[model samples]
Target: MAGKKRSFGRVRKLPSGRYQARYLGADGVDRPAPHTFRTKRDADDWLAERQAELRAGDWSDPDAGKIPFGTYAATWITERGIGASTADLYRSLLRNHLDPTFGTVAVADITSARVRAWRVARLDAGAGPSTVAKSYALLRAVLMTAVDDRLIRRNPCRVKGASSAVTPERPTATVQEVYAIADAIQPRYRALVLLAAFSGLRWGELIGLRRRDLDLTANTLRVRRNIAELHSGKRLIKEPKSAAGKRTVAIPAVILSDLSAHLTVFAEHGADGGVFIGAKGAAPRRNHFNRLWRKACHQAGIKGLHFHDLRHTGNTLAAATGASTRELMTRMGHSTARAALIYQHATAERERLIGNAVSAAVEQARKQAPGPNGHAAGT
Candidate 1:
């Protein structure tokens, strides 16, 4: 007797004694199973799973994820509407780290095991922790988009703690070292070094400063723009990273005269003129400044200090002044309290002062408290 008709798909015997399954998809196209099965029952079982997926609304076009990962990632980056500098960074990460592994692979073909292996290989190859973290984050972000697009069921970047990198502690410079570097550096950059250290202005903010942004009379420096210099020597001037980044920061009283001198002697002309510039009337480049920084450090007898250390020192010093977390966040141009809390370390000197104050408060309370019989406690 003839068998009962199948419901969703057709199973046919191949010439090699294998069974192939073909099914009509939601798109009204007949799609063959990717591989042949040894038995007709197995082929029917595979088709049954596809039918179940369709019924549950989890069915996706198998060909949709056939696009190469590199192609999808490039399109993803372009459609992200990110800033130029950020685009540059993502491109660099893709080119240097991710593309070599998954470039030609189909988006759906990437597996969690492959991702883990790739990360382990990168770590074994001596890639910096931060670089690896950034790359892994980028990979995960791209794969997540694929999942959203329904090109893949899930992201394969499932490694725990792979996106966070543990960077070593950054070194900070002292007041004496700051002055020594300032004096040792060229005359034009003297104010720049001192202002960076005291005002805690980032390199981009300092470079983007204009004459109109400074009001020495009020001892406040306005941060309106940030100049980012890419690795290719291209400069992009954009708004601050966050709303808090565009704020008015108090300039240290000691550096007011130096800033005045810098404006008069080195700064460009007009109210919109640049505040900090190179010796040849050009914007300061990071590479050029690094050479000058090295010489300055040598002359100052300071070692292992980065220019950012100056800002770190300033933040730490601000915290030392008993500045509240809100105050520190405002001064540091950070939108989050966690970023500010990192600088709020209690030094031994500050701890001692706090202890002394607490002890004094206790003594005063003891002296003023009423005794059991209504006499003063101390008496």
Candidate 2:
């Protein structure tokens, strides 16, 4: 007798003595199993599973993610609409870290095991932890987009804690050390250093400032734009990274005269001219300023401090002055409280100083208090 008719697919015996499962997809195209099965029952089982998936509305096209990871990743970067500096960094990360291993791999074939092994290989290859973290984050982000686009069912980047770079606590400069470095630098960059250290302005913000942004009478500087310097020395002027990044920061009274001197001597003539420029009337480049910063650090006897640390120092100093977390966030141009909390943590020393002063005041009050009479107790 003939066997009962099958449901939605057919199992056929191949010439190689294996069974192949084939079915028609929603698009009326013949879809075959990715691989042959050992037995007709196995092929039928596979077909049943596919049918169930379609019935449950959980089916996705198996061939959709056949595109190469590199091609998709490059396209993802381009479509992201990121700034020039960010695009440059992403391209560098992809070229240096990611593309070598998974560039030609199908996006759907990137397994969690493969991702974990890649991370281990990167670490063994002596890639810095920070670089590895950044690469991992970029890879994860790309894969997430692939998932959202239905190119893949799930992202394979499941390595725990692989995205956060473990940066050590950055060293902060003392007030005298800040002054020494400012004084030791070229005269044109003196106010630059002072403003960065006191106002918590980033390198991009300081370089993007114009004469009109500075209100000397109000002692405040408006941060409306940021200039990103690409690896090729191309400068792209753009809006601040976030809305909170565009703010007016009050300059300390001590730095006003230095800023005035800088504006008069080194800044450009018109109101819209750059606030900080080189002696030759060119915009400041990070690479060029790095050399000057290193020399100034050496002359000032300060070591192992980065220019970004100047902003850190300023935030810590602001925290020490009893600024609230919101105030610190606004001053630091940060939208999140995590960075402000870091500066708040640095206020432990200030807490101790306050405690000591309070104890001393209490002691003096006790000493002057009357003891059983109107006379001073210590006297």
Candidate 3:
């Protein structure tokens, strides 16, 4: 039988004398309290809480929020529509970081406290800061989607600065060291080293370059695509990572001659042919090049340097040219000014040189003036 109406919601007594509470949801669908109550007052209290949740706009679908973390996470990843490399990275994160702890937990059950504990446990397990940050970022993104899907009221990723990775200072090669390493490499790859240290192009971009990408007379290379090899040995060719990555960067006058020589001697035929190829005329993979690069570095006495550091050297040298941040971004094909800022900051050695020059200028100025300790011109 129907019972009395309350200020919040209607409560009715069932045939078994238990009370049932039902409230009209903000979604316009009437939903019952999660369970039956022994007393009318108990049912009324349950309805009151539901009303408050609705008023606060924190009410979510009870059924939808019950989805398991792993199930929803998989759905979220599929709906993201990201690139293949990015998809692989997210899958790796799920497999390595998230699934073990949160997979069975319901989305609604996730709390900020649990998230903090996860981060602490990851760090204690020897996970690096960058790895943890990336994992946390992926988790945050997925949970944000859950919030949008109305599966959860709020995201549990409350830790600030947990989404950004902190990288150690990258070591760069000097121009002389670059040349020494280039000279130590196979003659076919001499131009490769010069272009890497001078152009700021990434490995994928370099390996993706074709004969048509270079404008020899104009002394420029057009960056349009990139190629990456997955750990599973699958190779993917895709557009540049960012809009700014597709750009035209000029080659140094000195590198022009060497590039010309490389093109004449080793470049494969046809416009679509790769500008850089391995021993068998196939595009060079990073693993295959790693062995040769290690040998060259060893021979040049710069064994600790990674090939990616050549880009740092190139950008730093470009900054030394007094290029503006915008110009640096364009030349370096960086989407943000942060990298340009890093390149522009003078090195400690350069700072010392600047200090010495300033001191010398001050001393010369003092000697030229009629100071108390200095002789006058007509004294």
Candidate 4:
């Protein structure tokens, strides 16, 4: 019989000094794989170990193990659409920031150092800290899914301090400033501003208001839906952000009267029973309202005021009326007491005035009573 043929496979050196083993199987199929070793002996050992595993039917293709971060991220996003607004934001970030860097990198190769470098690059590219943090969060979430899928051993994004520090932008406005802005606005938008300032409604919530949502007799406004401007040149009506957001707020008597007057005068002829329609009775766009708001502010000589500030103004005024924190949270649909405190802080001056009144009352009582004596009458 002829001697058994040698079964040694061809070996090639990689640019990284690692050797790749290429071999023809008994079935005449060719396979190529990385040995992940520097020395020839180590490579040979790895190859022998892998061949034995193949013989034992326990071999796993190492190349097939590595999944590109971009591919995994896309799959995760498709599987879980976080929310319409959040998904849009994530898509923008992936297209503009993440895909460019880690799109081709293997999910398993994504180390904490690599992630930190990416964050540094983002900051070097003049991205804000908050933008960088959000990007990191998105990447981290994708990698976490990889861990769950057994594609990666660990998520590098979970490293402490991997996310950049971001300063939160202030989101509050004073009541006086909002009123001054409303007073200077054109008559068409005046009621709109008043409605926002008094109702604590979001921009979408205000624009989505139908005539039926308001009850003048009952002095209540039910917030059932919100209208958003989509990329499709038309409005999309969506449910409110939370269950608490779909609440019925008691309209102040003043706001009810204004709404009754506005309906009879301006919005009565609009289609769709809209309470605040644009010119020619079209569904109002947020941009149109924002532009009008800005122009009104400019004319009113008010600075640093935004249209959303009207909601803040409403919260501040409500807090000044001695509304408890719970009441304020309920009215504003704030999921946490921390958010309600922002509005309460805007009324800090009112708190100081109350403090002064209490101090004066204490001083009066002290003066009217005997000092250091148990006297029944004034000394």
Candidate 5:
């Protein structure tokens, strides 16, 4: 039934006198190698390696990884305990980028070469670098889970630095530009422009705000929840993406009047009602907001500015306040220095002021120094 000795494998001679390698696995079932070897020694060697792996507790059950990549990947994504938006993103990437190639492929059959080939084909087929990178990263994460499950001994998505996308620097609007955009938008959304450019709130967080979220006297907005609008016109009010994302950001006192006016004129609901609303008294979704965003940019003479650029403008303005790196991170709800460091660079206006001050200092030094003789006595 089981092997003669549990520690070592038992070999048998096949019908054609070839040796067959078989071992009683941890499951107490006799399993043979995929192929028979010509010599007993060859079969013995294979069993020995398998035995060594078992002894070391590093043996991966071949049957464990027989699950299809798509099935297992979908399972992993669902049980990952991530946010809804994150799950939705993973599902999209798996469907759009990975499924065509690896859907029917067994997890055990996904070799490094196959993964590399899929990535190459995607890049050659006009997929953007960022898009491919995101998909590849998701693939890597799923394969890593397989490794943890002992379905695979190692992950095959091994292209180093393939996970990091080289994103172009986002354009930042100036203070005057932000004001112009605000003035050009519908009166109902004017405060939206000002708040986006001044408070540095993400669109999701801004649209999810209610009347009680704003503290006019304290000039602070509490970011408690965020809304993700689906393509089906459904909105999901979820917790902030990260622990740091649920933060209180202080609004500039300058926007106090504009915000007050917006509350009185536009926000007709009670304390628990949404701060921003459309004509139907519902919150503005992305598509509806996009139309207004386009109109405002067009009227402001800025042809290609996304709503996100206003947050960039606000972050740059905060940096201009000489805020420390930690301060910027807290304000922007970022946990990493990489994102904080982006706002550390001075804005164009601040740099101009520095340049002018440097020029004045040089002029004063030249005036004090003696001409040609380089003496302070002017000799």
Candidate 6:
């Protein structure tokens, strides 16, 4: 007897009780898909659903699988066109840390367990908690993109308590310590340190400063651009991180006076009339500043002082002077009040003074009142 003619394209029965449907795709191309069912009716139903999905352009092959997490992340990074330095750092983190652990893994396959394991491995390899946390954040960002692309149903890295590692505190230098270090710096760079401490400019902002940006009349400096050294052995001027970062900061009179003296005596006078040029009248490279800053710190007998710490010192001192959180945030160009609070929190001594005043008031009130023993005299 002749077998019944199959109506819904060619079909093959597998030993595992699954039906394979081979049909011409919407593109008029041949395609095959598999569905497991207990009976021919169920298999036909599954095939019908798949055909509807294909007709609606919503069909996805179960076997097509997701792109590897690392590949998808790389594409996302390139498409977003992050700054060169940021791109380099992300790629380095991915290649050195992430790729090795999860490069071959599909975006859909990532789970909380996998992320936890990656974090533990990084920690075991002596990676700092902050570094691990950053790596995890990058990974999570990649997974989030995967979800957005519909490559994955959800981000697996959003597990609760995933980033609970204790991050080490960033070191900060006191005002006096910073002053001593500034004193030890070569006379030419004294103003640079002072600018960093008083004006709260980042290292790049200070280096990228132009003579025009300094309004000696107004005692202000406009942070228009930042100089960064590319791996290509050249310096590049880039815009500030945000619109707020490209603001004019009023310099303290002392720092303003010092900057005036430096401009008169030592500034190399760049072609663009930059203020902080090197010996050859070009922007000072980070290497030169790094070496000079370390030597100055060493001579001043100050340990753990970083160039960026001067910015923090400025913020701390400003906060100590009762600068409102909003004022400090504006001055520091902080994107959030949370970061500004870190600087405010650094003013422990000022907070302690308030605590002492409260204590003194309590003591005076207690002395003026009768004690539990009904003594009216001062105790």
**lDDT per prediction?**
0.92, 0.91, 0.89, 0.75, 0.88, 0.76
As for lDDT, the candidate ahead, 2 or 3, is 2
Worst 10 residues of 1 by lDDT: 1-10
Best by TM-score: 1
Candidate 5 lDDT, 8-124, residue by residue in tens:
878877778887778878878777898989997898899999999888988877888889899999999989898777788888889999999999999989999999999999999
For model 6, residues 96-212, the per-residue Cα lDDT tens digits are 889998899877778878887878888899987777777787888877776666566567786565555576665668768878987998887888888888777898889888788
Q: Residues 14-56, candidate 3: write the lDDT tens digits.
A: 9999999888887778788888999988987888788888888
Q: Which of candidates 3 and 4 is the stronger one according to TM-score? A: 3
TM-score of 3: 0.81
Q: After aligning candidate 1 to the native by TM-score, how far in Å is the CA of 252 from where it should be?
A: 0.9
Q: Per-candidate TM vs. native? A: 0.94, 0.90, 0.81, 0.76, 0.86, 0.77
Model 6: worst 10 consecutive residues (lDDT sum)? 1-10
Clashing pairs in 5: none
Ranking 3 against 6 by TM-score, winner: 3
lDDT-best of 1 and 6: 1
Ranking by lDDT: 1, 2, 3, 5, 6, 4
Q: After superposition, how far is residue 183 of candidate 2 from its true place, in Å?
A: 2.4
Report the C-alpha lDDT of model 4 over 78-142, residue by residue, as the tens digit: 78957676666777788788999999998888898898788889899998888888888889888
Prediction 4 TM-score vs. true? 0.76
Predicted structure 2, TM vs. truth: 0.90
Residues 1-379 of candidate 1 have per-residue lDDT tens digits of 2223588888888788888888989889999999999998899899999999999988889899999999999999999999989989999999988999999999999999999999999999999999999999999999999998999998999999999999999888889989999999999999999998988889999999999999999999899999998768799999998899989999989889999999999999999999998988988899889999999999888999999888988898888889999999999999999978988888888899999999998888777969899877666
